[model samples]
Target: MNALVPLPVLLPLCATGLSLAFGTRLKQFQRFISVAVLTAVLGLSVALMIAADMNGPLSVHLGDFAPPLGITLVADRLSGLMLTVSSAVTLCVLVYSLGQGMADRDEETPVAVFHPAYLILVAGVSCTFLAGDLVNLYVGFEIMLVASFVLLTLGGTGPRIRAGSTYVIISLFSSMLFLTAIAMTYAATGTANFAQLAGRLAELPLGVQTLIQGMLLTVFAIKAAVFPLAAWLPDSYPTAPAPVTAVFAGLLTKVGVYCMLRTETLLFPGNRLGDLLMAAALASMVVGILGAVAQTDLKRLLSFTLISHIGYMVFGIGLATREAYGGAIVYVVHHITVQTTLFLVAGLIERRGGTTELTRLGGIAKAAPVLAVLFFVPAMNLAGIPPLSGFIGKLGLMRAGVADGSVWAWILVIGSTATSLLTLYVMAKVWNLAFWRAAPPGQAADGTVLESDDDSDDDTDEGPDRMPGTGDEGVRPRHEPAGRAVAATLHGHAVTTTTRLPRLMTWATAATVALGLAYTVFAGPLTAYTDRSAAELIARVPYVEAVLGR
Candidate 1:
């Protein structure tokens, strides 16, 4: 089983090479390889999860070389769980993208390079989860960075280019900080291995330890989009193609949070910066949701909510108790699936409504009852509706907070409740405007304006403005009057657009929605698992002794 530790990282990477070699020449084969690889990875991840739980942490030194000089990967409960969830989510996204490609005739993701880049992204995510040292973790991030840039700019459209540039710059800055921190760690302790550092870092002076901790936390915070560092995300994410956006929103920030969880428990115990973490959590929850409340576009609104919910996880970490950590773990898993499902639903909404603007969308419930159900279920779950995993996770965290009985914990408890309510308000607003309201008289079911009844060539020069970060920077007024535009275009000329939802895309999204509900069905065992995972993380000895073979 220990020998299997590196396969999750290696499999996708090996498949990536094959994917690229096949390239545009073999599209079907490329799709097959991508799906098959991720599916295998997901299965392996589940196996690893069970094995790690039953047998303690699993570690394998690459090429039979010991840790200080060779690459090492460890799959403990945390990593195994993360690996499983991420693999499942990425696999679903890949299927969705394939359906999208077929539906759009490959125009949306025009390049065949998408498969290779996506596989690379999967490998990178797996690598981070299993990384045994700071340097290896840094490598994982870089791998993701390269692949993400390609995916973000897939179409090379203006908005995508601009958004991709911003994403790349922020990622680069964070990477540099991460690398610098790694160097500093190696300089301070002569080894970059996590298990070795756990013992050695304890011997350092209090100030040095604090400084290093601050550096690492800052790097991860930026990656995790915590409070002040999160401003780039809303602008960066909404511009990409829907599938790209879905996977990214689900996985990337959580990787950062996972790092924070691991280091906080194993390397920097006692929660030296717990107060600061709590403050960030408060600001992230309040500020991020307020941003969500102000958005009129569905995707941007979801992006802001993503930042806000991240605070819940951060709050759990700041509490630094077993229950809090467990709650955080559960929330992380819930958010990854729920958030991804919402974005995919957003794609379906866009497909049916022709745009994501709340002002223009109406009567989706009447037009496509299925799409409305897809959107509503995940939207409500996101708002922490009872009996859903979202509520279960938040309730646990709040309980942990109250149990702590600290003033800050109490404040975060209030903040968490408030955030949940605001999230509900935002989702309800979307529901009211995008689904319940009646469609305009001249508009088609898909939001396109139809021909005027009267034969008037007169144009009203009225239309919706383009969303920021979605290209078309300058607003182009509609040449037709309110009831006269056709195909929902910026210009007077009409262009053909697909009105029917793709079956494959819809079914893929339904699969994700089902996965989210599965959490609710098995909430008992899931929370139990997270609780045990949290305990293992806090103990720290299991990981250290397993890695060092002591």
Candidate 2:
């Protein structure tokens, strides 16, 4: 039983190693390995969740070493829930990537690098969730950063390189901050084990505690892309290939949020930065949604909304109640599936329409109703439409805020509601422009918008200015190149030359949508589990005892 605890992290690392060892020769086998490994990890996660629920926070001391010294991997309710959700999400994304890889078989960015790097990324996420010490957690974060840098720059497009550079520099800066905090922590307490830190951090002076807390939260904030720190995300994420962007948007930022939850509840239970967190949450929601509202490109719009929704999680953290934390947990799981599905759908949109620009995309509803539905389901879920997981999660958070009954919480309540409304409006706008409208002027029957069309000047003259940074020096416009497609329009569809979206990609995306819906179906049990998880997090003693064996 104890042996199973490390498998989630170990399996991915082994998969990555095998992928690397095989290199390009076994590329086909690597895909099968990726799926099998992630599926196995998902089963293990489900087992972990059940076992943790039954026995309370099962743990393993690596190499038979004990607490505050040896490596540890624990799957309490919180970590188990995260592992399960993340495993499910990563598996969906892995299938999506396989579809992408198979479809564009000869596309730049070696397939050999993709499987190993992606598996390593999964390992990092699993390690981050399972780590029982701050140092191990830091290692996980670094592993993720390194893998992400490769994934981000995969195609080596000029824009991808520039965007990847920004992402790497930001990741490194945040990492330095995290490492500095770890140093301060170890120097202050002489131990890095989470259980030990929980007991010892309080022994430091109030000022010292606050200082350390501020530094650590700032580091996480950068990783999480909370408010001011979020400016880098919208530009950076959209440049990657569809599958990479989807996984990064869904999983990476949440890892930071995960760490924040651990630090706020376990190590620094007082939550000295409550007001700061609340303020940042409000700022992120309002600012991010507003940015989304202005974006005319599908990917950029989603990227902005990603930043906005992080505010919701941070808001729940600010409230610091069990209900609020549970709500955040629920929201995190829902968002992971829903957001990833949307980006995968975006890939389909780009493939079929030859672009994701609102001005350039059209006739998706007519050309591929499946694409429209795939995009619509998750868009509605993301906007918090009723009877969906998004609604359930948001309702939980709103109720928690009301139950807290603080003036600031109420203010955030209002902010949350407004953000939801704006989110809906944004999705509706996307529906209108991308699915409902006729093809853009000069759109060829093959879905290619003629770049040099006589009406091209008319487009700029007629519509709002293109986004400022969107057209900056290095960035490629969201529209893919208009390859040599014969030009003609018929019956309101401009995409006569549309490439068929890969069936594998579509099915993978559809399955993810189903996964998001499943959260609504299983909300009762999931929420109950989260409630228990939040209680364990807040109580902290069981975790300590589980680790200390006292």
CA RMSD, predictions in order: 6.0, 6.9
lDDT of 1 by residue, 425-476 (tens): 9999999999998753323233333332223435453555443233434443
Using lDDT as the measure, which candidate wins? Answer: 1
Tens-digit per-residue lDDT, 1-550, candidate 2: 6689999989999989887887677667878888999999999999998998888888888998877689888788888888998899889888887776666553333567888898899989999998999989999999988999988877454567788788998998989988999999999999999999999999999999999899989999999999999989998888787788898999999998999999899999976788899999999999999999999888899999999999999999999999999999899888888889998888778767766778776667876899999999999999999999999989999999999998999999999999999999999999999898765653333323434212332333222322222232332232434421211110111222345778898999999999999998988998998899999999998888888787
lDDT values, one for every candidate: 0.86, 0.83
lDDT of 1 at 282: 95
Off by over 4 Å in 2: 107-109, 444-499
Candidate 2 RMSD to the real structure: 6.9
Which pairs clash in the backbone of model 1? none
